[model samples]
Target: MGRNTRKRRTPLATKAIAASAALALGGGGLIWANFYASAHESNNNAWGNQTKAANAQVATISCPDIGQKLTSVPRQARTEVDGELGNLDRQITDAYQRLMTTRDAQARDASFVQNSILQPLKDRRKAIIDRIKLEINRVGGSAPGSLDTLASCTGTPANQTTAGGQQQQNGGQQQQNGGQQQQNGGQQQGNTGQQQGNGGQAGNGPVAADFVDITKVQPNVAAKPQKSGNASTGVFITRCGVNANKNHNTDNVIVAPGVTNGAHHLHDYVGNQKVNAFSSNQTFLQGGTSCQNKNDLSAYYWPVVRVQDGTQDFDQNADGGGKEGNVGKILTPVQAQIKYVGSPTSKVVAMPQFLRIITGDAKTTTNGLANANAHWSCTGFENKVQLTTQYPICPQGSNVVRTFAFQSCWDGQNIDSANHRTHVAFADANGNCQNGFKAIPQLTMRLVYQVTPPTVQNGVVKNAFAVDGFPEQLHKPATDHDDFISVTTGGLANKIANCINNGQRCA
Candidate 1:
């Protein structure tokens, strides 16, 4: 679809703020409609009334991940197909906004959501899907007939039972469990009449239940695999300053190339300085670097974290910021550690130039946990526990941490894949590359932040922090992700592999 044909809808921030105010003024029927229920909630409901209420609390739209399903997009048609995928995302975002603002209508009629919001959204998606098929067929590639099946989306419930047995409320607040709250995995904590608060300043998410006291979580880190005699046991570290240059944008060049505001959320970038949706392989090769070693021109980026303290940033009214329901002050990480380590089972190979890797799923809240890989913890408790869904409430003097471990196995032939994932895979349990894949140096990133802990009192959260995400994702911690593009010179790539395979550490 052309830009001129796209309908201009009201910004989500404006609608969300207005809806929140209306709900605050005793509009009991109004609710934030995009909240995701916990995955465990479906199996643990015991109360009939609670279950009924949960069913009626239609919170989010769950649709098939078309990008994931297209594992065979032809190279000739990828650009057009990717644009259509981006359009599909925009359609969902608009539909989610309409659902959020029409709580009154939903309360009045049982089928209001299906008839007015979901059906229209499905029709739009079908058109986009058809366009994708046409693009593929034009390039002499066969498109799957099942592509049409992914057009329809269903409403997901709002309330879910946490692993600790506590229930989520219609407004995305944690319902107190008698006088105690359950932590993840059935752990119990005592607290009565405590409401975590409504989702952050945007009124969408990072609810109180989304945060847990890090001290209470048990140690769950797994032991590293033991190295064998022939295993590559070296490490290579890179000093890429934590986005100090303030290179931030909402464009995802690897996924939605040429589409402005393609990501719909702000990303803090380091390394290659001239990257955006329009950037090509040539642009990356010529871009300046943030790494201490100028030879490494790779780009590393992840969503920017924000503090919801009623403060507005430079993009307060912009498409990927407040307008998309990502509000508050953007935070720069206190420290960023980028390291690459050799495979545990075999000698490593140099990565192909321009290899693109995306770790973690940005839509995990709605897509489920198959691709979810967010690791959140506090400084002092690093080895004790890591969280995938909930944000950590760090203790005083202990900073918050976000970690990403990228895929280490490559197919040896393709630098990229249709879904951007099939080209690379994680090593198996035995640390061996599966199929015909080759082991490569694993990239691990650790980012630390100094943030004030948020508190929930009387159903209000103060100074809460959240990861930037798509508007419909509601800034859930589970949706946190990272992206990387390798633009290393052949010599530098060889040096990295030698450093690792030779069992030596280098920077």
Candidate 2:
């Protein structure tokens, strides 16, 4: 189910110095350690101790993503299927919480994690998967026979402690980018018995190793694809004031239409007023807009980024906030730039109304990195360097930046697919639409935040910031994502197409 074929840029070496001591549970019976070292560590005496501490296990549960495995669910069964999918997510979250809280039991008995936690989780998941199959069959749709096999889950180590300046391969390319290596300086022992102030208030993530100083990273951005003479080179800009209305929610209308708190993380919304899990196509058509142009009522939203400085937001006690391991003071974007550009190979066509598109993978930490699309950088270093796995530490007078370039090719018929991704695709590396798809206006979003750079001192991070995500995901940057639903009228859609095809920049 890997949609995007574009090669990912290699991550810069982290330079932040961090170290965490191993925790001893009850008379030193069981030891769990989560430790990291700086890339610049050259001391022979200290290297041996740090390397042994890094080998201690810090594990989390990993389950198959059921939604990605399904390619077809009947329209009549979609509502029930989506709800069941949300249930699966909730089950995992609950299991992860149990795994974090039951370290004492795990230390006492070797089989505690498997017997008390993972097995029960698998049984619950099997029941849910069976229910999903019945719903699909009830509507006369064929469910995949492999659905039964996806019910079993496994324990996987979460912490990855790499040697300082070690080289890694990405997409068959060798990268040797140099920079100040920032190790995760926070006290992040994933299963360490403590609850608060361990990497984050939720005791999961945003460790110091998750950030890289942007000034030290070498330039690694590739050149843009070349445009032919027939390319639509014009641009269209939309001004939707950056979530000033304070519209925030955890429901995703496109993925889990009828389920509340479906996203499991809070999203900052703009451009549409009437948006919720119950919203329909008609609701979007009749809703007011935040854009200056009244005719454009598109809905644009992304996961809110937060500073983990012990400040609690209103939702800190709610389902998708502190309760789900997403805690901190929410930081509103200083600027949100929404733009539409044309294809490099052909003229663009109008997008269908209510066409739903999602850019990044929300479960990428466990799902692997085939569909991860988030890019992070600083203001002036945008053209020089971009990071996919780590957050950027911007210099003074500069702000943090997040960029998302969505899929630009449409399948020409369905507004959405069962997987919510097969209906649209990214163009090939040469910028041509394949498989009978048509080129549409490419939507790109840029969000800027004025954040005080976090610092690591005495193996603890101060003012640590992270993107909101599922409890198990640990707020990794690769899990950052955005959602959009097109609500343009026919006239406005036609105007946008004409402007791009005629090579005229319009606003």
Candidate 3:
């Protein structure tokens, strides 16, 4: 055995170990790449695709879902494993379609993102949706699903209740909790039923209103100013709203310059010249919301929701790395997100919020139609809760500039975009700056509540409240008002009865 320090061992053992090491390293890298791509390719953009031009440069979105399984498969086959991920792609489409058609308002809550779609697939869906959105933004455009995905994803999705809620998905096309009549068959409660509680009767409340849909854009592009600068819908508002120390007089404020910053109104924001918010093909997905001090540093007032990264996996079998996009996108699911917790469902709610006139206060103008600058501002909500809307395309050659705050009350604060930030900052500003924050001569709101007769036992009856953590809750003590007043339904007060039972608390 001493023929030169024992017979030489076969080289095969060394080769095997080295090969194994390379294989493991490659596999780990591919997985990491998948996550990397997902993070980097999000569409947290605010400038919607309204202003984009068809001739603009379009970025390609490659979502390849493939992998070199850890079998003894040959490297040649693995390297050439280019195929399709139709199943996964279809899953995403199906989810989006489902989101758009859902009757349950809860499903569209911002926090429901993870609960309904992404987390369930273990990030597969997340990455894909995020990437698709990123791609859309890159091309200065967006897909219909892009809107659907963020439609109700206000918080970030995946709330503490998501997993629980999914498990509690009562077995029925429509769950009958206490034999209540299911009225969600696209029925309009008219103006009366929308504000009044659905206690099986119509009452003399604020009277039912209607949502106005703009069928076409006005050809004229002139700016209009308000007269008195103070108008109100004269409806009741929730407690938190009042407690926020805000002036329900938002309706009273006017966009002095008119359309100065919004989609059609931004002519002043850029002096009639188009300004693009995004200059590259990158995408940004809205991130989960976190509590931030509005009165704190202006820098952190609106931190980006999406955590962006670089590098994309273009290899069919590779994950998030390799190439910039050979691999499929799979962003993570946001947890406990909320769009707008306990938003109102009547025009009266919106009247105090979104509407205003450029002229004198309070006129019963038409909701959505071309008017002769009679009503400078336009907004209507609550009455029938206009869930979703797709705005008209911008005039030719004008791509969407992406507004920071174009949102539905149902959007919650999930987006926390520039449009909203601008408004918030404007409100916080003084004098002239605040003057144009909201359209002037707007209608104001005040909220009122009366307990359902049969549901109450005595004066000590149970009540409803909207709270921070509980989105469906309210400020405290509900009651109607004539003009401007704040109300956050919580604790107890005049509305309470001696008995405790089901109390309808609509925020």
Candidate 4:
């Protein structure tokens, strides 16, 4: 059917926050109507004491097995759905607050009229519906409701038609671009405006579209770690601890600013409640963390992983349509180390909060794959040759290990640089602080995937894996990166100094 000929009842556009308003109206109207009908029926009860007991019994008899069937849905799907729903709830809450507080209609309209959340929410809801149906079918039960029967506002304002037409045109252009990519055998890797033909030798290999060429880039080889203090001198404190559990679910404020529902995808965080593009040192310290150390209020975060059967069923782009989530569950690192590495005698002072640094470049999508500092191996294959593969399958009893080591040598000045780098350089191979640069506490993050494998598929072990990165990154393991915030206070800093220098294992 032609685009306009196809039928969909949901309203395409509105001057106000149409979805929220519609949801509110439907919910309130239903409740009020039900209450009124019940009251009227009670009045007609011939027996003045009309069996309130029988009705109560009927209310208590709950539906069977639907909850059980829901459990059958994959955990990754469940988490994705829940995350999206939570995000929508946040949007609705913000919208309601704006509507209640704002006197100006224009301002309210501006906040609500944007289609970013509307379409994405609809897509997620539909996904949930489809997943539920599949689960029900697998369990040999009838679906609770038909997809066509789902309630949604239909009809479009005249202005929306024009916008929709333009969107369709843009989509056509994108399709053409996709065709061009196929003709050239692959997509372009945007690095310093360098264009390597997809078939050219300089291009990244078969999986290059998903990774950066890390082999060629001057990798940030970490300095040999050294302990700073001695226990005999009373400088003993544990500089390392792991933050394993999740603390919050939110969108990336740094890369996809202002788009609350994540124009890209959702991220899971372990520390710093107020993490966003505007989050600062004071903000992080003021917030809390899931870390064992209350004083070590640093933030460690990455994208939630979802396991997939290797299908291109996601957006994989921060600014694209279709599936906007990664294809697999992101296994938490087997060990996440939070410690200081640098010159022990430097006597490091306070580490500032919101000092953001990314260890790997998510933007590079080719020859740059090996250009990252990703170390991947199985439990038993710790010594196995590690390469920059988009995904790694480990042997049975072994999980995939991913580690990220950040630049340690700071200029003794800026917390951040203009390019988000350059202010800090890596320590020398000898573990010595760089010349003219002061040794700062270098934070490191390590993640391990739970793809216990004895199996191999496509000549590689099959594993559930993903990295926290831009969708354009294609979830390539090479694109995996880590973010950190220094929430260390005075006492904690003193302890860290002692632990690293004194060579104590105290936590």
Ranking by TM-score: 2, 1, 4, 3
Error of 4 at 199 (Å): 18
* Clash number for each model: 0, 8, 123, 37
Q: How does residue 453 of candidate 2 score in lDDT?
A: 86
lDDT values, one for every candidate:
0.73, 0.73, 0.18, 0.37
RMSD of 1: 10.4
Candidate 4 lDDT, 1-507, residue by residue in tens = 111111111111110111111222111010001111232243111212223321111100001112212322333333333343334333333332232233233223322322333344345445655765665456555555544334121111111111011111132121001100111112323222122222111121112122221222222222234544421222222323333544334454433334454424445566556676445466777877565667767666665544332333233332221233343333445565554543533544334444555555443232232124454444554342343333444445666666666765666665654234455565543454554766556666555667543222221222233454433233444455565655666577666655555445565
Error of 3 at 80 (Å): 33
Top candidate (TM-score): 2
Error of 4 at 141 (Å): 66
**Span of 10 residues, lowest total lDDT, candidate 3:** 467-476
Top candidate on lDDT is: 2
Quote each prediction's TM-score. Answer: 0.83, 0.85, 0.18, 0.48
* Prediction 1 global C-alpha lDDT: 0.73
Error of 2 at 506 (Å): 0.9
Which regions of candidate 3 are displaced past 4 Å? 1-125, 128-132, 141-426, 429-439, 452-507
Candidate order, lDDT descending: 2, 1, 4, 3
Q: How large is the C-alpha RMSD of every model relative to the true structure?
A: 10.4, 7.1, 29.1, 23.9
